[model samples]
Target chain A: MDTQQAAGTSVLPADPGALTPAEARAAFRSGLAVPTAGWSRGFAQANLIIVPRDLAFDVLLFAQRNPKPCPVLGVLDAGETSGPLLAGGDIRTDVPRYTVYRDGQKVDEPTDIRQYWRDDLVTFIVGCSFTFESALREGGISIAHIDQNVNVPMYRTEVRCEPAGSMAGPLVVSMRPVPASQVADAVRITSRYPAVHGAPVHVGNPHELGIADLARPDFGDPVDMPEGHVPVFWACGVTPQAAVMESRPALAIGHAPGHMLITDARDSQYLVP
Target chain B: MDTQQAAGTSVLPADPGALTPAEARAAFRSGLAVPTAGWSRGFAQANLIIVPRDLAFDVLLFAQRNPKPCPVLGVLDAGETSGPLLAGGDIRTDVPRYTVYRDGQKVDEPTDIRQYWRDDLVTFIVGCSFTFESALREGGISIAHIDQNVNVPMYRTEVRCEPAGSMAGPLVVSMRPVPASQVADAVRITSRYPAVHGAPVHVGNPHELGIADLARPDFGDPVDMPEGHVPVFWACGVTPQAAVMESRPALAIGHAPGHMLITDARDSQYLVP
Candidate 1:
């Protein structure tokens, strides 16, 4: 059996949310494949993107240009498997699952990426909206996706990102139905963590963002829009992946959606104030 | 006569402080070299560093690792001369003066760098402390350097920067003596501008930072210490230049001391809420 099939047979932790970030990573390293939402409570989880050294500068420039959609938490230089964010953890094997892309097409979904590791590849650890969701919950706001027990709904809009070299694509956003009264609190709370996707890009009227149907999303499962709650959109980490897919590099790798790299950094560390 | 010598004979504007950023650049483009301390009062001034494309990534990584000392305002990609920060301004001719270095040794200090421009060069525009100095002054904090009619005193501290590839150097800081009562105000006002070297790195006791004498600064002129005042230091923009010098890149270019690029971006734009 392949690594993915073998990992599928492994049992997951009973209470993954209570595990320390290191412990959670250890579970993934031990061949337990699972989505990482609420895996480490207060610890920050990161979106991963690995690109070759030649295109690394362009990716960094793209992230710098479009910070809302791509807040770089940390960068592991070419051939560097570990850095400040993932102490004692090998990036190639710690993630629960990875999506490998070849010429913009998904070729394999591997449990570990050690076979594909290259000396010229650079890893960019991007901030995920999961960090701010905790803050939003702490502020007495309820998230529709979390309440519905599904992945957050994401849509690609007509808004084009500020392009850097060959990296260019339409802006992608995740949706949540928040009560009108708590919208301001959500914005104020999330704005403090600019390292993650901060504040709502569009508070109401999905049509303004060229999103036709609220029930249909380009990625993830749809959540119910409760009465008296408005649809809110935040810049999604998937925007970079979309750019990579559109740009069509020789090889690209990312964590499977909803399956992220649990980092050693705490959510509070990204809070500006 | 060369551009510098010819520009030395050019007449300067009667009130440079009242000129717009574009007008200031026009004057500098005409080969008139002068310090940009009070020019275009409300607009932002930036420190300039240009390196070959091969070394750009290391510099960007270094700046990311050491943000306080090198807050990147904007970057011009290899062979890219204009961008969002400076509209209609040419990076090569808009600055008041340029310092060219060959293998880390100063080779030229010319008014214009058009002759030194190359297609593979990448320019990095770094934030200057002048943006926050105005905020401090507005908050009722008197600035010692401006009051004493001298360049801000800067010292090389013993604290080493987090290294990235070939980039590594000690943290350099600019000093201003603020009254004990206004130290908190100074911190509060400047903290709002993280893009421009936010907050004081060291407040009192220069010995703690390995500075034996306050009067003998490694760069810039020393200012007087008013009675009941304590020395306050902010990370200097020179830190990157120091790193470039230490790293010994084949070629590097920077703005001469006190001479800066007046960007179209306003000081208020950099102020965080």
Candidate 2:
């Protein structure tokens, strides 16, 4: 075995995209910390939301009610650390980083959550827009955020989600600049993956969604917009985390923004004909 | 007002197919009891399952895990009756009839369930295969049960659903005998409605699904199979009811077989593309 494997230290593959979902997870488990974009290229990545058992129903209901914003990929039963989505993997240590929220406030950013994990906490794995980015690229549309080497801009819109019990919040959308000629192609390509955040909710004007400024996003970094490029907004995975924050549950946990759980499931598994 | 309307009694429209979803719901609310197949022709009908709030998360998770048999159309939050799926509708009284289950056994089949209604009960409106029957007809495939004037036959399959929490049961499938030539057409048509039971699980042979005999069904009335017809099976909405029966939750409620809640939402709303 290599020295890095023996020491349980990071020796990530030179071509990150070549690593399997499990390999990427193992790297994260071995203390490699980085955003998961462009990692495990053909596999899918998921957003994480952990809430106490008492509040899980509300979260599940919220996802059912607002599927576009909170498409559930799979859920782990309360205290379960592994499921089919993560074969031979531990949820507590698989993700690159985790955000701990207490009473809706950010309290800690940890690499391992076993210390804070509770038997009463249920984990929800939600679809991420990253899964469809490959489809967009295949359809000949370039991703602005990827080109700019920054996080995709996300804004909390004025549109309120269909509330479910105690869970409610404004829809959060991630924006990408699509070339004027390729906006339709982008929509057609991304719409095929409804399990992920499918289709553009808005095109051309960010102000229409109550987004005052493109450069000032509620979360993530803004991409450079070239002239003749239109801003296409998609329902963001962060919407549930926003809901968790607004509801102010006693405890909640989520993947650190931009970092995600790479799953064994392939991207083609989500693409509809 | 017409005498029939004034009496608060049945004066159903001569052409039951012409009645709007609201009108059909009104008929049911006013003591009319009949199968909803041909009524409200263009609107979507739903399967009903009500469980106490304590068991709702498990039910929701179960549905999430097995979406083919339990595509949730909409969910009525606990203690709430009306929502987007049914405008100005009362769940307790609008459905043609309800089957009350006590510890897995059928206790009552009542036209109205107000007396049994509880504040803690959460109602799940699941998609029914009836929505796709029209698409099949439009594709020039005749339905056996409709032609025979009998209920669609359902059977318990050897296939076990991906369980969630305490909810676990064998998949129950509805079988329709289609002419061998139109088998592809039936699958293509029904696959368009993923919100309903999408596509056939098996295209031929009854014994493949552990069904001993096509004439003897686990639920609903069996139909006459034509000489050239092949047994096609689709995941049935009874799957959740089967789970309820096997899990033996203290109290559970479901729509009696062949009777359903005709929602205001149109069938086109559920048809993909």
Candidate 3:
């Protein structure tokens, strides 16, 4: 019974506190795979992107230009498996699942991408929302997605990111409902972790951010918004994937939405302040 | 007469409290053509590198891989005049002097690079030693180069930086003589500013870093190392220029040694801790 088949039949482990990054990776490698959202507690999770060598530079430039939405944590050289500078973690078979994009379309959702991996491909592990979410939880803020057991609602905004080369797209953001009284605490907690989106791009009024409706997100499951709480929007890791898709590269690979690469790096290593 | 001719004939400003970042940039624009070592009081200065679009990504990757030597502050899109994200400052004329490199060789030193500007040129402003120097002074540590009225001693070290595509070279470092009692103070002060080559890469030994002689630097003038003072080496901005030059890009541009860009952004903005 492969991990994918097992995942289809029963609920996978939601609490990754018992597993190491390597163990979590091994489970994925063995096909006991699922989205890595809660798989490895207190460790840094990354948004993965693999592209052909030709488009690597342009994509990197786009990320640099739009740092708030695309904070790059580490990059792997073409054909390289491990980023020694980023805690010596293997790039291959690290994440549980991957989404293969061909010519701007999601073509396949595979458990392991070793078959699709190419020698000319460059890998980028960008900052993910999980890091900041952990920080916010530690600061006494309860995220509704965790409680509701749903994916955080993500939307494509009207805000245009600074373009670089052939890479240009609207900024995509993820929303979390926050109590009005705890808004200041949310900002203070997340601001300390700039590597992972760092601070909210918009705190209130989804319409102001070009998000027409809070309940109708372009991606992910929309969570309930209480009356006393306001919807806060953060620059999403999905922005890069959206940019890559719009650019229409011959081939691109990303983590299957919530599936992330768990790195050996500690979350505290990213706290800038 | 232009500012350069006037600057060569007069004693430069010594008071660190003389000018603000905005005033310094304005002065540079109005022909106060001098190396910005001490002009902008309490402001962090930056090393500028302008490269053709074809090589910008490789250079950026090189910088990211070797952050200890090339801490990037802001990167501007090709042909863009202002970096509103870093500071709303014009890059072309903000630096006091610019060095033009053709096929890895120095061609000209111009006060303004408006004539050499190209539509496909990308600009990168890297953190400079001035940020740390200011912190050291604030902590009551005296820098020998500033005291001796000479350029900081720089050496080409044997340490090979992590290579990126088309950009790989030995790490070049700048040395400052710090008193034995103040070495800790220097580290503590500089560690707070990682955006600037944070902390000393090496302390107390020049031979370990492969420098044969303290008085004879590979680049820049050597300052005296007094008794009970150790030579502290920091990863330098020169590493990127060396990497770029080694790659032999057909066209590359950089700030002249000692000369730097004065941005509207304040130094305090870069203090990480």
Candidate 4:
């Protein structure tokens, strides 16, 4: 057997776009857990938010009102792991890792959430901006953080999201450093994928959004901003997760930051125009 | 005091668009409950769907999956009829007419649903195509049904909508006769409003949709089709109502055909690109 197969490593091929959604999911299911950044290239990566059925309605409404920050890709019924749109995919084992919360406090980070499974837990897979990064790359744009091999920096902003029931909090955003000349191209390309946070919520001024420093983000590693680069911000999937923290549901479950659920749905399928 | 005042008619002013949404809603509240065809010219008109909380998630998912046929404008929380989105509007007494269905059968058509309103009921305002018809009219296209002073014809097709939980049924569509010259214009104008069941679902052929006759329709009145015109069909809001019938929920309430809930939201608010 080849050394590649012997290691049992799910190292992406040289051309990561060749990876399939099902294959990446299988890798996760088989305990080959890792950050799913380069895997399942064309398929959309989703932010999984699982909550007890009692709080599902509030969270669903929160996602609906703050669609730009929390564009929902698919919502699975309570206790049902498989969905029709996902082509019989399993939610419990499909994601590499999960973060479990109790009363808005992070308590445990589990590789598999099989022990925490309950009949009243509702699962919602929200669209991640990672789905649109591929489009920007295809459009001949360079993402600064990806080049640095790190998670995209995210910040807590002053902009308050539209509140629903008990779910209310400030908006969260992920930053990308784009050359001044490519700002319009970035917006144009991202606008097509509204299902993935649409266009940039803020473009030129980070301070206007209550982001004090680009170097120290609330989450993820910061990237260097070159002379000709301007920071662009898109509504982050973390907004709903942050709101969940503020709302303090009895129990909440989500993917660990940077790890995502790769679905069979292609990014192109979510394009509006 | 004046001819217009003596007639007690809220006739269109020189600029009908100048009419405030509150004035239009007040008109309906005062028993001026007629088909809201020309009221609040540029404001959006929505189809009202109310169901018990037990079936709320199923209905919400159904609308999300079959967005074209059931584009939702606002979904109110269970038991709360007042919403911030609608600007202090009350769902129970706001709409002019409602059709109540019990166990998949029509039971009553009530003007105000205040008596039937329950604490566990959830109200949903699904976007009606009537909002887009005004845009079509503004684009210099004439509507046959408006000229003929009749309801747009609707038919049941063999095409099944994506089911959610107990919600499952054949798709229902509304038909309009468009001149060969204006078909493209209709599609372009309506495509801007995705929240209003944007664009034509099927154009030129009814037989392919399992629709056998143009003159005979399951709902609404059939209008005359001119020789130069072809029938164009749009996904109708009645679809969920039909699905409610197929699902046989304990009780389902919806707006009577042709009557809709006019909202403070402008039709332009729903336009995407």
Runs off by more than 4 Å, candidate 2: A1-13, B5-12
The digit string of per-residue lDDT tens for model 2 on B2-46 reads: 467435686656877788888788888887877777777878889
Q: What is the lDDT of residue A33 in candidate 4?
A: 60
Please report, as a residue range, the 10-residue window in candidate 3 chain A with the lowest summed lDDT. A1-10
Model 1 Cα displacement at A27 (Å)?
1.6
* lDDT (CA) per prediction: 0.86, 0.88, 0.80, 0.83
Ranking 1 against 4 by TM-score, winner: 1
B1-273 in candidate 4: lDDT tens per residue? 225523546443453346576665554554445566566788898887789988887887788779898887888877988774457667776676788999989899887788888889988889888888888999988877777867778899999998877899888898989899999999999888888999899999999999999899887788898999989999999899999888888888998776788888888999888
Better of 3 and 4 by lDDT: 4
Candidate 4 backbone collisions, by pair: none
True contacts kept of each: 0.06, 0.94, 0.12, 0.12
lDDT tens readout by residue for model 1, A37-106? 6778899999899999888888888888898999888999899999888899999988988889888888
Q: What's the TM-score of chain B for every model shown?
A: 0.94, 0.96, 0.90, 0.91
At residue B247, candidate 2 shows an lDDT of: 92
Candidate 3: TM of chain A?
A: 0.91
Residue B257 error, candidate 3, Å: 2.0
lDDT of 3: 0.80
lDDT of 3 by residue, A1-273 (tens): 346633544335555656777766666655655556555678888888889888888888788778888888889888887874334445666677788899888998887788888999999889888877777888889988877877778899999998877889999998899999999999888888888898889989888778888889987788999999988888888888898888888899988766788887778888874
DockQ (CA atoms), all models:
0.53, 0.93, 0.40, 0.47
DockQ of 4: 0.47
